[model samples]
Target chain A: MVTLEDARRIIAAAEKKAAEIGQPMNIAVVDGGGNLVAHVRMDGAWIGSIDISIKKAWTSRAFDITTQDLATHSQSGGQFFGIHASNEGKVMVFAGGIPLKKDGKVVGGIGVSGGSGEQDSTVAQAGEAAF
Target chain B: MVTLEDARRIIAAAEKKAAEIGQPMNIAVVDGGGNLVAHVRMDGAWIGSIDISIKKAWTSRAFDITTQDLATHSQSGGQFFGIHASNEGKVMVFAGGIPLKKDGKVVGGIGVSGGSGEQDSTVAQAGEAAF
Candidate 1:
């Protein structure tokens, strides 16, 4: 049962991290069932950040692994190519996404876009720390 | 030249961030042309997260604004009304997307899904950082 307050805290933490790094970002948080909880888009953040952020969360929840790992595979010409198109409108074969878990159970996910991939990942790492 | 390697690196960094945060998400990366450069879909992300993520990336590329901002407007009944469908399979009204830029020029976009709008955004933010 991920509540709005929890999502808010996560967003707040993510925002703080972005500010610390001097990077503009857009962040998002979701629940166990893959539902939205909270979101924040910093001023000057790129517009596409919104999609990348959500996909990160979705990828995390779906694979139960960090989106980065999947990204690696995709680039290596592993299963990502075919897999990306497998789910139709439900799967994105890029990067910048992660999943949220509690007690070894996926409860939700998070994603971010803006800045370089490294910078984007940093902010997401900060949000996860908040939890 | 944003090669496939660049996209791969961005994806890797974003995934690392996701793992550190312990969140599950679906992530996507695009080139300056809004064409998919790299992507990764986690094992179990929700079906809808994929669309949300891509939309985020598209939103960023198209409007030069974060998907979160567009989401706010869409929800608030702002100016973009009907603008979502205006693109004909190019624009998404939902959350989770961002654009990629190089040297102040829009190069491409990214998107994520499978989490709350907030979570999705967070993952995208991470990708942006990598740039």
Candidate 2:
């Protein structure tokens, strides 16, 4: 049972990390089951960020791995190449998503959109570290 | 480089299949990159069907697997549980989506919304068979 407070903290950490890297982003956090828990659309973020955030969160929850890891597989054309269509609005399979774990169990996930894929992923990684 | 013709044919086949089962549905077909190619909204379909259709199409394009495969894992609480947030309007992870393949290669996906999950999946599977 992950709390909303936990989701907020992760978002704050992710925002801070984006600022540090001079990137503005939209972020979304979801529980382990892929349900939306919290979301933030930053000023100057891209319109696509809203969808991207949700997708990133979905990807993290579905794969139980960082969005970056899925992106790696997506680029390599491996077993994950065509997996994105399976989840619909729930999977990004691209950069900028990370799963949040507590005590070795994935409790939630964080997603960042608006920046470049690399920058979004960096921000997401920062959020994961905060948890 | 898939065209609208391809999408329309798939939709017709899927709709025909739904009729065979006495299910009314909203169906969507999307290109390989998750872009909209064609869409059909049936009479008496649920309002949510539109979004669900898009999401299902998204899921197929993003995952490169039939929505049925994704639904199977979603039911089991596997790594795919939370990936739906990443693609926003594109991924469904439910039973109503199917990918379109040609010459054993994936080119697009079809999604049906409106019926029960099982019914929707059955119609989608029929569409796949048409192609």
Candidate 3:
């Protein structure tokens, strides 16, 4: 179970990184239970990125893998070629989602959107650092 | 729009109230767009309340009124007698949902479940106070 405090700190760190990069972003965090813990859309962030951010967090927590890895695995001729079609389309096989671990066990996940894949991943990495 | 911090504080307040009332609960918060912002299910909370709580928050934001008030309006032969059938069944006319307003504009909503209607309302009220 991730505390609300943990979620808040993660989002704050992610938001700071986004501002530093001169980008607005949508960020999401989910607890071990795969339930939303926190989510934010910075002023001027793309509205379309909201659900993407939340689903990225959920997908990471549900699969216990960073979305970058998932994307690689889901590539054509790879092990999870059609995984994106599952989970009501909530499985986002893309960068910017990372699981949060505590004592070597996944405790939550963080996701970011509204920027390039590398930028989003960078922001999500900042969020993960808070844990 | 309710920030992630706002949602976290609201959930914290709701959780505290639920603990004091000796009732485990599922709580959900949604932004002005009626998108999920945060959610939590305390240990031992009824699993059935998960979707109900989210929908309750959605209903509150969609209508800009408390779910309790919506219930009165949805009674048979009332002005909105069959309103529940609309919105893909996301409408929940109950006592546990409330809208969060800022500067007189409806900005978000919170919902609580897994207890009696009165108990759920009490917990939801605690969340509303966070804003």
The candidate that wins on TM-score is 3
Q: B12-66 in candidate 3: lDDT tens per residue? A: 8999999999998888888999987777777668768877898888899999999
User: For model 2, how does the per-residue alpha-carbon lDDT over A9-107 read when each residue is reduced to its tens digit?
Assistant: 888999998888887788988887888998998764544357778778867877788776775565333666556657544557667888888888888
Cα-lDDT of candidate 2: 0.74
lDDT of 2 at A98: 84
Interface RMSD of every candidate?
Answer: 13.1, 9.5, 4.0
TM-score of chain A of each: 0.89, 0.91, 0.98
lDDT tens per residue, model 1, A24-59 = 888988788776777788987755456556656766
User: Model 1, residue A81: displacement in angstroms?
Assistant: 2.3
Model number with the top DockQ: 3
lDDT of 1 at A27: 91
Question: What does the lDDT read for residue A75 in candidate 3?
Answer: 95
Quote the positional error of residue A6 for candidate 3 in Å: 2.9
True contacts kept of each: 0.10, 0.32, 0.23
lDDT of 1: 0.67
lDDT of model 3, residue A129: 97
